[model samples]
Target: MASTTPQGLCIHPRQMDFELPDPLPRHWHGGDAFKSHLFDAMSLQFPDGERFFIDSVRYFREHIGDPQLRKQIRSFIGQEGHHSREHQVYSKRLRDLGYDIDRLEGHVQARIRFTQKRLSPQRQLAATAALEHITAIMAEGLLRDARHLEGAHPTMVRLWRWHALEETEHKAVAFDVYNQVCGNRSLLRRAMLMGTFFFVLDTSRGLVHMLKRDGLLWNWRVWRGGLSWLWGKRGIYRPLLGPYRDFFRDDFHPWQRDSLELLQRLRGEFDGAHQAEEANGPVPS
Candidate 1:
């Protein structure tokens, strides 16, 4: 099992720029529009969504008694801020592809703003913890299966692998903050229930729009490609069912499912890849 101790985690905020050239296909992941749009829709929310995560945790910084957790929170904020900036560029690239990405992102921001105005800080913090769990599990799903990202744009794969690894690294920061400040299991569970609904609803709505725009909404082959990606043993989400249900456990913690070995393996893989790139001639700016 992964250590639940905060001291074992290293939260680093990396600033990265992925050059997804114009030559890349609209269906960047596995060359399937459905799969690509599914991720694209999720990317649309990351910039503002990450800002909310940062704000929610920082709001209760005064309540934290542990110095280690306080440091982790700072790292978490820095990491999420950089993630937001990177994904903003990613979502904008979809706009350059003629999709209505900005409009969907605006809608997502509107909902977040509405929640901020109408909800209690405690509830907002609970919502952040809940969503963090969701992302952690989704990240786990991706990291577990190397083949899950097979045939994706190389830069997109690197970007997502980095995101997933960091998500694993700092999965517990917000939840730790919420627990230290305002953890009501019943209230957190309720927020998770509703949050799950809206998360799916919003992503699906934007995905449908993107699919329609790509003229893939009615394409049977496109949907088959999506089904193949989302169903069966190879599916990224099928394993998430167990982890997602674990969120409702009485003493739930993101570190309960130990995938530290997987993290270690990927870290080595990515490190060696980066070293090889460095050894090569200078990459084009």
Candidate 2:
């Protein structure tokens, strides 16, 4: 199954307590409601989504025999746990802003419950692996490009960059585990198709809800500008298309795209900050 992930890959959790601004700016992404909510919608899903990823991978943890992969599984759980906690705070910020965070999260929670109850463990892990690929590609796109967060609020930008960085680090953990346990390419392919559909659906639902709450649901200009930014010539998401399709290839491995250099490059920005947060102690704001 395309050989396991790179031999020396180290996956560890980076503890970061991002101080999200009080009463987060209504349109933190360049004062653009569409841009901000698009990300917000996705963030809203992370708390529940990440937990499901943890459970799905943890289900197969005991079945894995490789010592290195087993260690990665632990770190994967740790990283995702931290992500879920941090995004819960982000969700609370949205709640404080009157966005009906509970209602949105309820939908994701319900879906995960049903999946866990009805789907096979193999299917569950396949779904997790597929979703990881989805996040991994987007994470790489965000780190490699600037326009995605151009004009975004500094704190929000840092929060996302941190999440993206970790996502890149452990992106293949679930896939590697799935290969070891269930090596079913057909199942993984189907999971990707279904996972992508629901991801888009749920994110869109959250986006529309936020925009509706802000009274911009029907605004044509908002739609035009946001759609252009996503799919237009030189769009931020346009570059992800090729990488997204690579998951279906017979010999595909997450490391084949070779983002090790990019990961090392981005680590410089975060690792130092985390080290300082440790050395100097977190100053009381």
The lDDT of each candidate is 0.80, 0.89
Best by TM-score: 2
TM accuracy, model 1: 0.90
Cα lDDT tens digits for candidate 1, 120-167: 999999999999989888888888887668888889988888888778
User: What's the alpha carbon RMSD for model 1?
Assistant: 5.1
Which segments of candidate 2 are over 4 A away from where they belong? 273-285
Q: Estimate, for each residue in 19-117, the C-alpha lDDT of model 2 and write its tens digit.
A: 899889989999999999999999998999999999999988889998778888888888889899999999999999999999999999999999999
lDDT of 2 at 4: 50
TM-score of candidate 2 relative to the true fold: 0.94
**Per-prediction TM-score to the true structure, in the order listed:** 0.90, 0.94
lDDT of 2 at 210: 97
Error of model 1, residue 89, in angstroms:
0.4
